[model samples]
Target: MRIYVNEIKITDDSIKCYTEESTEGLQEAGQMLVDSDNYSFAYILDNGQSYSYLIFVQETWSMLHENKGKKIIINDNLELEQFESEFNYILDNIQGNLNYGKEFVSVVEDTFELE
Candidate 1:
């Protein structure tokens, strides 16, 4: 599967993320909203399942401090363990931004296949 980050909207109160996936075909995958200062991230999956969580960043206070928080959106219809595993895999493999103090945010186009 190929994941494409389509757009990112940054605002004072929240950060809204939009993404597309090219697997069987190109399709909108999901959206994520990170509310400012609260660290609460809400995800609306492609299949319409929703989840929210509080993310704690150990570093990059300068980068994320003003945006409130950030969230990543992936494909839908995954079990919690599957989702967590895939998420960890992405984090482990992706390169970090040197200028942002390890807090990397970008439009990603990468292959990620799940068993």
Candidate 2:
């Protein structure tokens, strides 16, 4: 959904960044995006710093799917009430969607941080 780069908010739809060395060494990884349209809607990353891919998707799902079940550093300060409301909204709205996986709705709180 949202990634903080040096504490700057970066959403999934943001533009991509890359380093010079990656141009050749990561040719296959580069091709991974160029060759597939489905994945084009997203970016694949291996957890490096600075230069990385910018997945093309909505903020929340991208973050949820990308970092599923993984421990990530989130904002140290956040609003608990607002977070719970948003999480509940997502769960209630998308809960019955089998394509998105019914499990996803229940998993909202697991993917976010609320101080």
TM-score top scorer:
2
Q: Tell me the tens digit of each residue's lDDT in model 2 across 1-115.
A: 2222222233443312322222222111221121122322223333343334433333344444454333222232221123223333544444444455434433433433311
What lDDT does each candidate get?
0.33, 0.32
Model 1 spans > 4 angstroms off: 22-115
lDDT of 1 by residue, 45-108 (tens): 3433523332323232223334533432223222222333334444344434333222232211
Task: Give candidate 2's TM-score.
Answer: 0.25
On lDDT, the leading prediction is 1
Cα lDDT of model 2 overall? Answer: 0.32
Compute the lDDT of residue 12 as modeled in candidate 2: 43
